[model samples]
Target: MLAWYTAVVYAVAGAGVLADAGWWPTAALVAASSGLVLKAVWFDPWLTVGVLLDVGVITAVACSWPASVY
Candidate 1:
């Protein structure tokens, strides 16, 4: 149930990223997912995998190394 929502949110955020909708919206989605991740830490089988995926996405977006040089 929640895992499905997480997937949907990720899809939305991914689309926002592709559409150049700014990072704030994506960040908000990711932040919302953070709580879902924590909430699902108990019985959700997708928690580990989903969290890892979210961590990767958030890390990539939050990191500020270079815009056109990376």
Candidate 2:
């Protein structure tokens, strides 16, 4: 369940970056997604929080700049 949600979040971020997300925002999303994946792969307890935070941040950034997405 959690893994599926995380994967979806990554897809959104990747699509955003691939489309028209700015450099800094793209970098942030990449770094965040990478960290979350690392946590999940390692069975870290923080994985849940990390993924949730990443999703929230990504959603917020997207909502904040609807025009930035092209």
Q: How many backbone clashes does every candidate have?
A: 0, 0
TM-score per model over all chains: 0.54, 0.45
lDDT of 1 by residue, 1-70 (tens): 6656666676676676567665545554465566456556764665667567656555665674225422
Instruction: Give the candidate number with the greatest TM-score.
Output: 1
For each candidate in the order shown, give its overall lDDT on alpha carbons: 0.58, 0.64
lDDT of 2 by residue, 1-70 (tens): 6556656666776666677655546655665666566666776665678768867766766576556554
Per-residue lDDT for 39 in model 1? 51
List candidate 1 stretches off by more than 4 Å: 23-32, 35-50, 65-70
In Å, residue 29's CA in model 1 sits off its true spot by 5.4
